[model samples]
Target: MVKVTYEIVPHDGGWAYKLGDVYSETFASHDEALEAVRIVVQEQQVGDEPVEISYQDESGKWREEYSDGGDRPEVEIIDRFRPGEASV
Candidate 1:
């Protein structure tokens, strides 16, 4: 069982969505990541990728994170944009 870390990061232009990151090495295939995201999104009722979720950690601090499948897309670099402006 590979554990993938999904992060819901803020989009500089459009709305945020689920993004997946691999957390474990148990599964070596991309399909595993996709399956995990499909299940999590369905169960969590998230409508889009990079879904935002809040959870309490051992220290009682609330943490927010976004997660998704590992096989979806690749981000070559971070980007920033003003509202209503076309992405450059």
Candidate 2:
């Protein structure tokens, strides 16, 4: 199964969670960021019927394929910050 990681980090004078090179909206506090990630995690676990999908990959090629909605990737969150440590 594919494993996806969301990492919390400092962004734009606030906090945000990022997957790969993409980031969510910045939050005013780390707790808010954590809450947002939790909500997304819950949503990602819901399953549906298999369906056809299409997308352009990094190589700039458009591809189409069928995806088993139940084949969702294992998702995780990584927060490097400790209570009193500097933010990353």
Candidate 3:
């Protein structure tokens, strides 16, 4: 299973959660941002219906396959600025 991590950081003079280079909308406080992350993580745990999916293969050809709903990625949230560390 793929592992995903949401990193909390300061952005746009406010707090945000980042996954790779993508950042979520800014929240007024760290608590607000953390709450948003919690909501997202909860949503991610919900399984979707198994469905046929299409994707481009390495050869640039379109391919279709059945995706299992149970194959969900493991996710976690990480605080970039731990307690006692200077606030970003």
Q: Mark the 10 consecutive residues where model 2 has the least summed lDDT.
A: 79-88
Q: What is the TM-score (0 to 1) of candidate 3?
A: 0.86
State which candidate, 1 or 3, has the greater TM-score: 3
Measured with C-alpha atoms, the lDDT of residue 13 in candidate 3 is 99
Better of 1 and 2 by lDDT: 2
Q: Estimate candidate 1's alpha-carbon lDDT, on a 0 to 1 scale.
A: 0.41
lDDT of 2 by residue, 1-88 (tens): 9888898889999999999999999999988998898889888889989999999999999999998888877887888864542222
* TM per prediction: 0.26, 0.77, 0.86
Residue 30 C-alpha lDDT in model 3: 91
73 in model 1: Cα distance from truth in Å? Answer: 21
Compared with the true structure, what per-residue lDDT tens digits does model 1 show for residues 27-87? 3333443444445545544335556688999999999977653324322211232233211
Best by TM-score: 3
lDDT of each: 0.41, 0.85, 0.86
Cα RMSD, each candidate: 14.6, 4.1, 3.9
- Model 2's lDDT to the true fold? 0.85
